[model samples]
Target: MEKGQRMKIVTRTRAGTITGLMVVVLVLAGLALPAVAPRSLIQDLFFILTMLSLAQVWNLLAGYGGLVSVGQQAFVGIGAYAMFAMVILFGWDPVPAVLVGGVAAVILAVPTAFFAFRLQGAYFAIGTWVIAEVTRLLVAQWKALGGGTGTSLPREATSDIMGVELIRTLFDVREAAARDILAYWLALILTVCIIGGIYWLLKNRLGLALAAVRDNTEAARSVGIDTTRLKWAVFLIAAFATGLIGALIYVQTARISPDAAFSLTDWTAYVIFIVVIGGIGTLEGPIIGVIVFFVLQSALSDYGAWYLLTLGLLAIAVMLFAPKGLWGLIAARTGLRLFPVQRRLVGHDINGGK
Candidate 1:
């Protein structure tokens, strides 16, 4: 080592500047999409944003928190139901109602965590599912929202949405197009918040503790990490975020049913598939996974059962060949990370892991 040389210990990625510029360009492009893109495309973007948010939330819980919950649908359904109830019974604005749903999910998470934290590993996963079923049964008893059947948001409620009229005027589109744009905008904001929040969390000290716990809970606890509190906090946070996404989804659809809202396949299975297919532990994994899943759905969904079968087969294939996921494989080969989180000491010996 030369005495005149200095070590540059850093957390910033080599690609950080380029990645930040790319993100800004993408966001600007997305916001202007309605001007050139059709309404249907806007609706599809909304779907992608909402589902992407849900997947990211799920990934944070299972991938980093080591709480592999199989019943995130519980939070989704609870949020959707709460949003509907607020609109129907209390006459709240649909937009604000979505926040109410998140709060409801947070409240639900209290008891959910109390029971779920009692179990470990696979048992915890199953326990969460059971609690979801119980929640569904209880929600099914609410007659105001059509009991077990379900109901659509009244035309008045949908038509009078906060920004729909303004969007219609600004874009010179029809009511429906305007509505889709509004939903798309909300989805965009929410997705950014979810991803950004998770990224920030992973960069902080708690993220280190979370990683330690994920590797070995006992070892983490031996080192004085409050694994229990961390798990509970993560479970509750995921529930709130997932719930908010669910409520936003139904708010745009203007429809809700217990079965559809609480469906394991739509809310939980698909999300798990997205995260697993992309990369479980990495933040960028969900983004890549959701894009791939959306592509498959768009291309093959018309084949009905074939689409489902293909997804299953592809998931199995990825597990067998590229256990870390598609993004993981590429990163391993190229040392690329769209959302880099791992910290490495690489400058020089004098860096001293500083």
Candidate 2:
């Protein structure tokens, strides 16, 4: 091969190898880090997973299906509150309780999708916000759960596990460390499972339909696709995943309240920010964005308001200059992917008439 062709081959090979290595490393690190890392590190990893999951769900809807919703928090709050009700009131195990909360969120999404579907574009956004606010108010006023103030799992509250203990004292560093690590692993597993499920879904016919619907609903429908039904499916799936993440958050933080649980500022902001920065419409983008966001947050948290201001500015910059997002930009330019969800061209068709 000529020098230029040889260099091209070398570049492609290196990129492909590095991409595979990166994915392997990520999966291994997620599975093993909590078991060996210090408590603080494990906690941080858990937070990253939570953020990543949020970004992925948002990407699945808005990025892939063209569903921009400002009220995903409705499912988040539902997941948290449902977990509380199941574990505390019904005396269910935390693990099963989390799944129950996820199911409840999925169930609730039916009605939410029904009503919210009536709106379009900005109207849809407003409808979602209204629905979230109403849900928040209803949960807050229900005194049995904690009303507006909040709800708490008692200090001595124990799940069905006979010998397992709840960590109550931060001063007990060892105990806190143990609990944090366990929680970290739980979050990691949940994140991996959700991402894997998404990957499997996207590789199927539904995934192609979702992509078509996102790119151009009118064109998609003209081709005999059921655009409305596809949107509803995306909505329900997003709600289910968001709710499951909420339960994971509650389990790790060991607390939940209507206000904090349903807070849209960070939840909405992070989801959008992550998907935008990482790359919308690509599964890899959200995960990458989560890592970048968490690192920035941890590094600049001491700066307080400045940290948030920095994030806002960064997000705006990403949107304006790189709408495909950071991951998307890289994928477009470099043609590298950790998961390889789509195929790209490096060479033309061998059988071309030309």
Candidate 3:
């Protein structure tokens, strides 16, 4: 074998091992979170997982699919409200209701996609925001589902049997802690699975086609790729993921309101901040962005607006100095990948074995 070929083989092997270990470690950490974390810590971790999922879904749509949407809060609100309505009006279990919320969001996404797809570029952004506003108004006027005042999950709604002291006693301390931990692990696992699912998609033929369309939609269509269908498919998938995360958010918080549910700032600003800071296009970027976001949020929890201002300044710096983002910068320099999406030959086999 040629020297170059041998070196290439070694490099690929090393990269594969590194990638495998990174995933394994992360998975183990997530699984073990509940057992180790206290009740208070578990809540915060749940919030972080929620943000991570949001950042990831947004990254998938904007970074890879080239559909820069600014109104994912539409799905978030839909999911939250769906969960609320189910628990309040229909007497459904919150666990199942959460999944139902996601399904409902996807249902809404279909018509919304039809309208949003009619617009292109910045117009689509505006269309999404407008659609969200309209939906919020409609929900607000509909008094059946809390109306303008919004709705809350009944305290007793989640129990298997209403006001069962035995159940409460069983779940009061460690049992409740265990349940919270389980929820955290569930979110974490789903987040990792979703990321892996997206990675697999991008590594496949459809992903290549999406990339082609993103590179040049006209050219992709000329080559027989259905750009419209592709966009809608991605839009729906993104909606599903966003909706699921939204449900997760409410599940942890145990409450919902239109102001909180439909707030674009939570989904848009935070996801954008996470994606931009982490590196928009790469698989690991959102993860890094979430870490940075939480770090700042934790360190500056007391400083309030100043912390936000600092984030803004940092984003500006990333945009100016590292347009590709933090993950992009690190990937460019160190060639390290926690979840590598691409593989390339760095060398070839030599005439004789190394």
Measured by lDDT, the strongest candidate is: 1
lDDT by residue for model 2 over 1-354, one digit each (tens)?
Answer: 333332211123465568657767887877666445667777777888888888888888887788899998889888989988887788776667778778988988898889989988999998998989999999998787889988776554433232134432322345446556556667777787778778767767778788777777788889989988888888888898999998878876777889998888867877888888888888889977888798888899999989888888999999899988888788888777666445333433332322
In candidate 3, what are the lDDT values of residues 1-354, reduced to their tens digit?
Answer: 543344441223466577778788978986665454568887888888888888989998999888888889899989878877888889887767878788988998999998988898899989988988887787788687778777666767644422233433544554345446556766887788788788788877778788888788889999999887888888999898888788767766666777788887787888899999999988789888999999999999999898889998999999999999988888789977666556455543333334
Cα lDDT, model 2, residue 142? 78
Per-residue lDDT value at 295 in model 1: 98
Candidate 1, residues 39-142, lDDT tens digits: the string is 88898899999989999999999999989999999999999999999999988889999999999999999999998998989999999999999999999999
lDDT of each: 0.89, 0.78, 0.79
Off by over 4 Å in 3: 1-13, 161-179, 343-354
Worst 10 residues of 1 by lDDT: 345-354
What is the lDDT for 198 in model 2?
Answer: 82
- CA RMSD (A), model 1: 2.2
> Candidates 2 and 3: which is better by lDDT?
3
lDDT of 3 at 219: 92
Q: Would you estimate the TM-scores of all the predictions?
A: 0.95, 0.87, 0.88
